[model samples]
Target: MSQSLLIFAKILSPITSYLNPNTKPPTIAKRYKGKATLKLDIPQGVADLLLKGVINTDTRTYECIVEIIGDEDGSQSDTAKLVVLVAPSTPVCKIAGVAEYGQNINLTCLSEEGTPSPAYKWQSHDVNNVPRPNPPKTTDKNGILSLYNISKDTSGFYICTSTNEIRSAKCFIILAVMQPPMNKVSTCVILAAVAAVIIFGIIIFFYCCRKKNKPEEYEMGRSDEAGGKQLFCCHGIISSSRCAVTPTNNV
Candidate 1:
């Protein structure tokens, strides 16, 4: 009689769990660790989620088993999907005005659209070019960035990152400060005053020109030789000689 050799194989179902409470749960990959051997005792739904690209791991307790499926040759396959979670979605910042030395600055971050709440952090290009003081500002609860009364030393590029095991987003904020001797508000006022003075001078010049062009007037009076007789007109209509003889004494 010849001896017989046999191989034993076990088939297991997939892992299906709710990754997010509000959104549809993601599907896990079918093969984990590039293995084709299926485990026994996998649930029907869980087996499907595993094939879709999800890794089963109890984040809170880490009790879930990781299953890997391989091909006929037993070579590892690339069908499993694992997601890393980081928070705050679409983080960005804007400058209210020119960031100047010793000026109070405001920086805000928003992450309302992310699956999981994101977080904020401030960074600068250090002398050695290293990212230091990671997580300059963060909240353990929610994602909201608020920086009030900022100073010149705080001027630099900031990064806002959002991740939740499935998807991620990033944004950068550049802070620049300018300290000039001239104040912006005072410069505007000075320019306005100079303009007003120039306008007033122009108005006075036009008014004087109008006054000089006015017509002059002269009053007509009787000549002394006519003895109260009317003065002679240029056309001789009222000549002194044409007066009545009552002025004969003058003649």
Candidate 2:
């Protein structure tokens, strides 16, 4: 008994397609060459479509039909689904909005390819690359990390990870949060003026001390709360498939 086979690629979306069954090996369609082939065992009454190196695009519903050569009305058909799972690819990192003090900014990370639409995570580090906590009102959703009223403390590095059940990939960017230009310029000028005055005073003191044959040195140091750049802690959101850092007393 000889067998004839018919195949169609269709799924929930209903794409009309047909695969030729009139060749010695049961020819696959042109677009399916190399990607698809047929396996037939006449004696065993079996015919199957073999797919190779399937990708995300290959995920769909397929239908197969089998007919006995002499029995025009005797045909069997079956439908099946193919689902492809892919790991997240390396994400592209970006910064939206200005990273200026007291201004809103968003850090966005995107994975160009993934099967299940990867989730995202954002982590912050200090200038020293040491892990740091996010500010009071940081919000991360879908791949957008929103920081409100960024300050100098927000100046550092940020890493974004894209993840799925299959695997994960990551990308990073530097965030140098700055004061507004006008404010920054004014601050610089003021600091310079203060330094000059301090220097002039030191010169006068050294001159007077030199005349008296006495030597003394002055040292200046500065410390700020944000300058400490300590790592922050987090209250993780488990249900949302987000990655969160643990909180520490240092926060």
Q: Largest TM-score belongs to which candidate?
A: 2
Predicted structure 1: lDDT = 0.45
Against the true structure, candidate 2 reaches a TM-score of: 0.60
Number of clashes recorded per candidate: 31, 2
CA deviation > 4 Å runs, candidate 2: 1-5, 11-23, 42-45, 67-76, 183-251
lDDT of 2 by residue, 154-216 (tens): 889999999999999999999998767897789999999999999999999998777566343
Please provide, for model 1 over 1-251, each residue's C-alpha lDDT reduced to its tens digit, 9 standing for 90 to 100.
Answer: 12111112222344332221223323434543343222333233232222223223311221243323332333221233333344445655554454665444455556555433444444444333455453344232233444444455565676656566556666667665556457776898899999999999999999888767745422344676647666653322555543332322434
Best by lDDT: 2
Model 2 poorest 10 in a row by lDDT: 233-242
Q: Which stretches of model 1 miss by more than 4 angstroms?
A: 1-89, 96-98, 126-129, 134-149, 184-251
Estimate candidate 2's RMSD in Å.
27.0
How do all models score by TM-score?
0.31, 0.60
